[model samples]
Target: MGPPERTILGSKASVRRPKERLEREERPRRKITVLPTGRQFAVVRMDPLAMVSHLDLDSVAIEEASAIKPKKYLVYLDAPQDLPLPQSQWCRFWVQPVATTLRPAVPEEGITSDMVLPIHPNTQYAKGRRLMNCTPQFPFPHCYLWIRSMMSLRVRTKRGVDVYDNDKAMTVSIDSHVAFMSAWNEDSRRMFALRRAALSSLSGQTPSSEGKLRKSPSPEVVQPNAEHSPSFATLSIPPPLRIYRDGSASSDDEDTSQASDDAESPHAPTLPPIPPLMALAIDTDVFGWAADPKVPFVPLVDLWFELEDHLSPDNIPSPVELWREQETIGA
Candidate 1:
């Protein structure tokens, strides 16, 4: 026993340990695919007046929409088709009339007898849980219902002094485009942006053309410090010393020049007995200071040196016979 009986480190010890560990850890990394279901519950029938209100009266063409025929139209509520919670737990209806092109009705003028003003739903709510849920119909939970179809619905005459208010006359006119609106909340907007980015990345499109896009800066490459530079990131082990000795019963008076020539000549007609050569290389990795306080990066310097050395011409292991040896050792 030498000193404290320390065990001698063999060649493949480091190689087998990491190979087994890395293979086990790298097993499960698969891709996931998800599809979106485009469904919505409510519809908002915007009024022409809403659009007119948003426009600047000084520059707008208010009289341009006078000849346009007004009819009942439908604008389905199109949410971004995705929600933060997977399922929508709460529902709300936001109403904003188109004001850019639709002008508000004057107080003195009355709704026209020939004009068609589709009444807003009296009561509206969602119906189904995950898919299609039905909201309430009639006696609207929120607004006062006003349905007016001058030709079909009978008009009631009021006995008040003001006959103009009682008379069914449509005076205020706004552009028809003001009757449509886009629906989305803050969370929905964010998810829509993410979806748009993913689609754009797949199709190779610019941000401006896509409905929504993301802009992220590229990572910067850093230069290494001269003081900290080692060929590898970590500290390496020194190679083992190999000693070769040749002993032969030969004449002591033999010419030294002839022996040297026989060993060095590549086309020599005669050959001498080969000498035994031993080669050993060992490697180890040391930990380095982490850029972040919580995370650490390991530096692998000569970690693979021993493995590469063992497979060299001087130390090549028998592959076919090594498996049998390993089986016996494991058994």
Candidate 2:
């Protein structure tokens, strides 16, 4: 009986059992179908001030708006635009002038009558749930409402305001950009400087309760530790004073055949001092995406008031197929 159990027939069954189990388990998991994959919401108007971060809403005021409420409706987005959440997750959502009151008024002494401020002063966010359905539903139930924009918005300025008629504004479809905020937040001087400033602020003095951004201390040269000698900061472009006839370079600068920085020798081209910040500022080019005007503008901010929801898989776009007269479709 034991010999029979060890036979090729038994061995085959033993091998097949686990392999079949694994195949079953490894079957591609089904993605739950999230209905209303996207939504088209109307952003009655764009609030210029929403563009600015770290702004205190309490102080800003809309002294007077051009129109209390513009009746026109022009702009609309695809309903339930692909969002970061799964099939059923809601997204961060809100709109300007949620309140009946306009934004705060500008103090007249410093503010002229017609200065265009990047702020929707005195305007408030639409009541908590008025704009997008931020209220999270189990698997994103609020999605039934699927985030809608209130009509009749008042876009305001310091002295006056212009109403963006929903009907006049452009309609746009948003697919996730392959290079998501690459130049700005991920790798940019302004953002890096800001992060450094924030870190320095936290590490150094306590900030005032008034919510003012504390003036950051001037940048300083950080000395390297004793163990990590020959740091990048300490390394300099050895002036190309002396040219080599031809030879292998040495690991140590002292052993190299290059000439010392001596006035008697022909000097390397005098390069202006390149501090790290200056080097970074010059290296950063936010305009890289500006080569084409048709490319939709993706706001650097995290908010989703007007921008399309791009995080969800459903929102991901299919590759465009190009052809002259006819092209073969993949089998």
Q: Report lDDT (CA) for all predictions.
A: 0.24, 0.25
Q: What is the Å distance of residue 133 in model 2 from its true position?
A: 26
lDDT for model 1: 0.24
- What is the TM-score (0 to 1) of candidate 1? 0.16
- Candidate 1 on 212-308: residue-level lDDT in tens? 5343322111221233221212111111111211232244336676777787899766656444331111121111211221111010001011222
The C-alpha TM-scores of every prediction are 0.16, 0.17
**Which window of 10 residues has the lowest lDDT sum in candidate 1?**
296-305
Residue 98 of model 1 has an lDDT of: 12
| Residue range 122-201, candidate 2, lDDT tens digits | 21222222223221211111111101111111122111132222332222233211111121222234334444455556
State the weakest 10-residue window (summed lDDT) of model 2: 322-331
For residue 309, model 2's alpha carbon misses the true position, in angstroms, by 25
